[model samples]
Target: MDGSIKVKNLTKTYKGDVKAVQGVSFEVEEGEFFAFLGPNGAGKSTTVQILTTLVKPTEGEIFVGGINVKDNPEGVRRNIGVALQETGIDSVLTGRELIEMQARLFGFSKKEAKTRAVELLELVDLTGDADRPSGKYSGGMRRRLDLAMTLVHNPKVLFLDEPTTGLDPMNRKAIWKEIKRLNREEGTTIFLTTQYLEEADQLADRISIINQGRIVAEGSAEELKRTLGFDAIQLTFETTEEAEQASKVLYGIGENMEHSKEEVTIYTENGTQFLPELVRNLDEQHLSPKTINVKPPSLDDVFINVTNEEKERV
Candidate 1:
């Protein structure tokens, strides 16, 4: 339970006055699936790079598994595994060769390296293609191999940056299952960064969203979604006229009543409790909706709201 990661006041500035990351701070508890959610160039990669010792931070402190990164970068590296956005495998090498080489680099003996390589290939479900040249592998296959290579040393903390990007649904789900297994069974701390909202929602125990080089919001997916503090009730009508009429009828009942061509959405504090009243009010006005749906706010909604609010301030 001591394999936690901590970052304090992390900042990184580049040439040409580019602030890639600014005053970011967060903590990942031991054995936690922590997600960094953000769009491209939102400092997600920059933060990961700094954490993994691929880049030095301009200012701040970083600790992995309770070892200070700046004080002992090699120690930090020893405790963590990284699967970056780009695959760095040698295509001419077989998948087994790549994993064996990684194990060797981590100081495994020749015999031990082969044993670890076989274990990892099986763990990633690439045992069948272990001897295939990486150049002949598909994109998904290559990704899985890269992930296996990262695990060759049994790292206590794992960093995955957009691990499922460009993968088909089947492959993405396969990777998700592996990641969950690693965290659940191995007790490895996972730090994942991705723009996929659903990925973060499904895999992360807690999510921190970055925008414009700063942390915009941080919470569990449900907590962040509940920051809006309302449920949405959507009403679809046969005509725009009906939607407009329905909006007037629901004017004071819900906040932020929105209407489009043939749909209306209202934000209510307690949508379930208010739904019946809403229906009765609309029915009294002869404005029955074609369909009604009540749903809790989603992580995507929270992301959009937080990023838009940041944009407006800028």
Candidate 2:
């Protein structure tokens, strides 16, 4: 009740009786970095909108920063900072002007707004480009500027929706550094919704994956990976024919298996223990692999498996 976020039995239904979100419930401790991951149209956006007070829920209780969203939407908004994937950056305004305007919107005087702008520009490493029109800023630079705008009021909670969706790898890393700093140095609670699974795996203290309007899994990256409960043996053969053959031979030996044109990936418990038998089976079949790499289950595997299961059920 006194924490960053708490929701119970949250549901959202639209005009056509579309159940966008169904009985979703979760919590985020103050200062915790939480990630909400889902495929598109998995009710992720609708849930965030409700929490941020941009949309109303059809049923259930929702609270953010200790305020009930339905009862005091304005109070909930005051304690939250939201930087969405499509958040606009006015092309005509300079970075400095934009940030100053945001500060003023929160009731800062001219002098205070200017000072706050200077501080934020420094915080996001945009001081050098503060005077340039935002239209000239790079994608990454614009993202940083947008993030700085969100923090103008120093809200207790920050919501970031795909903050690095289209940036090149180098720019994405830069944004990741800034976001990590917000959590570590400023002790800010971050609720992140990212298209990049690696970003969520690396940045969030805990992750919740929603599928088909319901939470299918939730945990730390490692914990979620463990949920799959198997190590992957990634075997690459000399040819597509060989790879297909390997899958046939390795069938029933693994908990599950998948293969492509030239790669056969077998998932099984105790990969090391299975290696000896795998080698023998390949030798017997006269199949020589180009590479055989063993790895623990990755976040990608967990996400795909969970969502794929949901699809199968539907």
Candidate 3:
């Protein structure tokens, strides 16, 4: 099986001929944590479904672990573990039973299945709850069990679509830790999809932002943010008149700089260079900037900018 998961010219169309995914292409490297981020209707799930062979693409070339997905989806399934957003667990089964069953279904011997089940429960920190009925488990525990089930085959690649979505803050952090451990210790490749920007920023080695069925941006968080330069300087004023006066002084710093209410925001290339001059100019204008803050563009900002630009073109 090839280590990399590659997709070329992928597209998905519904019955009404509405395109869900359009010509999306990317590569997930061997043993890398890659994230696909977008809003609810942005084709993220459609792409995952196509790649994992749950749904066929209208047009595309997909290779998972070097096996042609279209030709041998079962082979691709054998090599990949998928923990979808929806948990597929039997409430009647005990946690241990669930894991054991998954292992057995993957062709593990009885003894090996039990041992692997124990190991997985321990790794996911659900060992203490192994004897409990799955119906009694919490949302987070259920999610962990779902992931454990997916790993019964020790798949090389894991597809996690919003694994932490409904969990509380603590549970979310706990799941994040387990994900990191799985990647670092077992060297598993993970393809993640999430609506949370911070999750993508924190976990992904590289991020691809999708919108309106197309990839609008792709890069490391820092690299994409750097492209926007250091913009948006915030300033406080002693008085409304003073703020208004300061706004006029640094008007040229941005394409459409503005001073609204109490703060003056200017988009500039070199914030530091512009700061000193801005202060001096404000002083000349008989105004004082009580607080100054310069924030570089963030992934959220980039998402908004790029998507807005796309909307304008239409």
Candidate 4:
């Protein structure tokens, strides 16, 4: 690809007639933190595997760092570092040893490899434990070591697949901080694949959501939330009938104006304006809601709304 990455018309199919990716296309710019997000079995791993040259796409043109992966996969491999969802670090090997091996695989001299190993251990906050066998490290420490190994090759681009899958909140935060620092200080373009929306929101400059082997949404976190409107208002009443009446008053403003046993939830563009109008209508109908809450739309809401829209069309 002339750019950092370019994939066009990508498709992947497994046995039993299952299509994993369907005509997926996207371009990642240099030094960008791009996230691939999706529910389980949404073809995320398939796409990553193709881009990293682990699996060939059934049909597509994939280029990484200006090299066509299908044609010059070796070139692509030389320019990219991949930390897969599965950690392949040798349990018996010390963190320093694994990093040294990775550096030499990329053709580093023995002295240069040793120097880089120490640097990466410090970069990933593993300097103190660099001599410990990977089997004795915590989950977060192992992940950091994996990342250090990936960076030992000094790739222009780094691929991280669910890098913080099973870590405590504190450890997850620590990893997130280092990821941002890597992108900022080293100018390493990151292709992060994660299931957690919050992780993408925090780290990705742009995010693409794939579902059912197709892209459902793509944008920055704020832009995706904007597509779902500005606010979500919850109105709770004393009875279901009162909630139903409120829905009629707010019908045109919200589509999924759901009414449960005693509450109604509505989507609106400007909840501040809509709430007053809703209150007036409810009073005229002899209904008074017991509670009203207005909150900004979130990425979770955007995912639910966009995915539901896709399902209905199917």
Candidate 5:
């Protein structure tokens, strides 16, 4: 598949010399679900804004739908749809009104715009509430309406910035279903930025995790998880001091060893095979763990492992 979105050496700086985005580069293939996974203030939104033409970049190249961003921002805009985190529909406008207005703004004729509005309301499963004022709709309903408005013009590429943030589980699932269908059925390339670990792991075909303005890790969920090459054995001690001491006593026995408060997590190959040896090490050091559990590497671990620069290693 061709690259639907391409970004190269992209950098953005604010007035105080703070680098919001630093030489970041990645590409999203056509009809692929690509996620920019990061915590807040990690430049996910900045990068999205630049690609959507709402904000200009300080340096590097960008293209959307085969159009150069800098040379033809307007042309790029025409081919893309953006649904930002905040839903800003007018309180008095009904769901249908919001969608119809959006379709008309994109140059749809009066009759065509009305027909398009009805189709979108059904698409987002809001046909039952089509005529209800947005202010009266629940949070999930409002979010769905905002999403439908973005789809009025049938954009080739869709940019969703934290689309399901602050939503309940059912509501988040609702939004995910719609977007997944768009990608599968309509072949729309999706660019999503999210802080939710499960969101990226479940929805993205590939993910790039960013932290402190740099791309820390990039791969499919399974590929990134495999990088750890070990299971995590978590031991909880009764006291923080014991946890700290246990970390030192078991230093070279594990891969990336780290302790926080009363918990020490040891990552190593064959975790089940290493449990007895681990207990012996603690016993020899006169330390006792209150509880122990083992789990495979997850996206949450990948996030924490990459974001923390001072990783304790064997």
Candidate 6:
């Protein structure tokens, strides 16, 4: 538990009566990959800022690596590394110079700083371009350089806020691979925040979804999806009339139903078990669909369900 984080009743309120985070509580075990997920303006950034000591919480407490954030902000900072959404590296500096400077700022000797710089360049797969000015680097390369700079201190915990936000799919996957490797090989604790459902599903050992300054759900990706305990079967018809007609016959078989102009989605405990009956019911109603698809519950479904429920309560 050396690199663990403990948060209790954390709250942050900005000026103009804005409440960014409200009574949030969670824990991240040592060496764990934890994801904080939400839409824009959901307070994920505010929470990360609080945890990283950039912002003070209005209520409650947070401890990083056994150090109270408010009591010993420097201690908390010393043990953690942060790579924010924005690439803050100087455009004039080469990748090697940036990392070496970061290491030197962390108290490494000149020789040690150079050694750490080379090691990090290799770790981030930027060795070939280590001497190139960062201003000329692509978006993905700049992100990699930022990550390397964050690790120059060999911190026990890492905070990545939307680390792959603007990258293409190929670059996003490459960054994901590097993050996974670091967590696995270095045993570093990771706290990540992102809007991408696929990124959380792929990277987090556990996830917490925040909405309107509150945590609506927290669990493993599979666990959250399983909580729905149903599969979805989507049927696409020629028109809304046919879909509405089919819905009437298929009403009682599923727990929930959603219909669009030309499609109807049914959520049931077992889609395969209900498929034949659904088809027969539609046939009897003289309704035909253009396509049918069944899929297991996914993280997107969990997010939609939780956030929608929260919205209804508000």
Report clashes for each candidate as comma-separated counts.
Answer: 0, 0, 3, 1, 0, 0
Model 1 bad stretches (over 4 Å): 228-301, 308-314
Model 3 per-residue lDDT at 14: 90
User: How well does each candidate superpose onto the true structure, as a TM-score?
Assistant: 0.79, 0.83, 0.79, 0.82, 0.90, 0.84
Candidate 6, residue 134: Cα displacement in angstroms equals 1.3
Clashing residue pairs in candidate 1, if any?
none
Instruction: Give the root-mean-square deviation of each candidate in angstroms.
Output: 4.3, 3.6, 4.6, 3.6, 2.8, 3.1
Off by over 4 Å in 6: 235-249, 259-263, 269-273, 286-298, 307-314
Return the lDDT, model 3, position 68.
Answer: 88
Tell me the whole-model lDDT of each prediction, alpha carbons only: 0.88, 0.87, 0.84, 0.85, 0.88, 0.88
Best by TM-score: 5
Candidate 1 or 4, higher lDDT? Answer: 1
- Write the residue-wise lDDT of candidate 1 on 9-62 in tens digits: 999999988999999999999999999998888999999999999899999988
Model 6 steric clash total: 0
Query: For residues 1-314, could you state the per-residue lDDT of candidate 4 as single tens digits?
Result: 22288889999988887999999999999999999988778888889999999998999898899898899889899888899997588999999999999999999999999999989998888999999899999888888898888877778988988888888998899889988988988888999998887899899999999887898899997787667655778889888887777777777776555567788877778788877777877788888889999887554555567876877899
Task: Look at candidate 5 and give me any clashing residue pairs.
Answer: none
